[model samples]
Target: MTVEPSVLSAVDAGVATLTLNRPKSINALDHPMVTAMDELLRGWAAERDVNAVVLVGAGERGLCAGGDIVAIHRDASALSGSNAGDDEAAACASALFWADEYRLNADIARYPKPYIAIMDGIVMGGGVGISAHANTRVVTDRTRLAMPEVGIGFVPDVGGTHLLARVPDNLGVYAGLTATHLSGADALALGLADHFVAADDLDAFLRTVGETGPADALAKYAQEPPESAVEGRRDWIRDAFAADTVAEIIERCRAVGTEEADKTAASIAAKSPTALAVTLRSLRDEKPTLAETLQREYRVSLRSLLHPDMAEGIRAQVIDKDRTPSWRHAEHRDVPTAEVDAYFAPLPDDLELTINAAPQEDSSV
Candidate 1:
């Protein structure tokens, strides 16, 4: 019998590297992988010999697609039928997964040593959680970043609400609701990424890090990114997404009467109404700390797990391979205010998120 490691960790020249090893799945995060990473990072954070840490994916396709929602879907499906014992077991498994994953995210945000994430390819949802919190985020021409949880009948988790709330203007709302793909240039323009290195120059850039350390090496290879697709549309994004609610945003977009506005409206229409409504509220928190937002998101995640739309959305998108999802509410306005409010309510002390400490403020980045 043989066992395969989900994460590959190594140290060379005082630099520690963690590679997400499931290339075939675009390094999608499962419970074991998340637990392994959390343990490794905590150990490395306290090690005197480890000067810096680097995170990257094994394949060229992606850094990480997101959490292993397929596994979650399976667990969610087991809640019914004639097995009461299975139901209890599945519920416990699901709760532990979210609890541990959120804790790990908070740890990365407060890491004592320099943490660098080589965000080369697809970075979305849980992927964003791991890399975006790092001290140094490196993006390349191939980077494709988004937080498209609404499409799956889920609000953005893994501290996504925290990061989205901080993006300039109402662009965060636009990105969260519409699930728009941001190129490397777009990510840099939006402050979601730091350095932009061409894909071809990545190996040379990494070798330079091995020779002269990350800061100096990254500075050498970092170049101005190409013009951003998102930056050009900032005016329309601000105007259309500034509304207080998802329904109002869609109305504003329709009123604009432009091709882009119509397309934006169409995209919003396709997502889960309940998820979109909750996402809008989540991103509207008044400049919350990462811990504060994660606590709120933890509540929403558990509530959404029990919601019917989540399972239906997953079935339509993943199992059936159909783009059309049958959301619980047909329109954003159909989602009751009380239902949206329920997601924000506090959980019991046992289930609430607890960070080790406040993240150290760094203005130098």
Candidate 2:
């Protein structure tokens, strides 16, 4: 028997359904998966028969855990090594992965048709990149969403800075820094999710949509979520994370003198100091377009790939499973402003993220 592709695509009526198929890995995205998704989406965008698109994962565990970061770690390591030929090969591979991933992210943000993402189970890092930009993001009670890049010594990329920066108040800062997991209800509260359907009802909802189309079928299933865990803490989250810098934010948390505040402070203290500082600055920039934000993120990602801390971060958190990362700086204050600023610097012309014109509308849909 022939093996199926990592990404499975099918069309019923006018709706195109794309499923991430690596169930064993919770459909963690790799280079081929990203490339396949980009190509399929581009094709479907212009196809008159494909009215809308539904994105989902194949397994019960989650939509996606994240990207194939272990592969990236290997490539980055090779790029930093003594072998010139291996370094060139690794550099090319790394460049292709990020550039294409960011382009796909931009495409989803501007997709003309109703793009619905079923955000079931764990959605983090690259998973967020794919689903968060959808026009209609549906989440089930089982959903757990986050952008936990700081823990791995990387700032949030794949246009995460764009979504985090747009959230109200300073909740984005808290989420990015603490790597807090948001429940389904909390996801809706933060405007990260558009609808909530109970986990048990998901299959029925999908069947109805496949049979009758989305707008009406989705309306039938979408229900008001329960009280959000994040909403209950909004007052303190706003107060503690309101400061301009990571250090100040921690100080504010301590001043509150509450257990939750103390926990938040400790969480921030454990992350890579350089990552925390760079992430704070990325969230603060006032970029006007998703493409612009992605371009800036591309710069940050390349810098992080070369920086010493990223490898160490991945080694401790992922490779060795030590959970004890030896970050370059001891504290957030120790990360120099100049070093943080360098991450956002402009890349060479050939390496910049190139976004084409917005996809044309398909009125026939």
- In candidate 2, which residue ranges exceed 4 Å CA deviation? 79-90, 361-365
Please give the RMSD of candidate 1 to the true structure.
Answer: 3.5
What lDDT would each prediction earn against the true structure?
Answer: 0.84, 0.85
Q: How high is each candidate's TM-score?
A: 0.93, 0.95
lDDT digits (tens) for residues 1-365 of candidate 2? 98878999999888899999999998999889999998888888878888899999998989988888798787656554534332253256666788888889999998989899999999999999999999999999999999989998889988888888888867777888999999899889888889999999988888888888888767899999999987887888898888988889989998889898899999998999998999999988885588999889888887777776787888898899999888889878888889998888787676677986666655662
Candidate 2 residue-pair clash tally: 0
lDDT of 2 at 67: 87
Please, what are the lDDT tens digits per residue for candidate 1 over residues 1-365? 87568899999898888999999999999889989998888888767777788999998799999988787776555542224332253255666787788888898988888888999989998999999888899999999999988888889989988888888877878889999888999888888889999999988988888778998888899999999988888888888888988899999999989898899999998899999999998888887888888788877887777677887778888889787777778778889999899888776666566766533323342
Determine the C-alpha RMSD for candidate 2 after optimal superposition of all C-alphas.
2.3
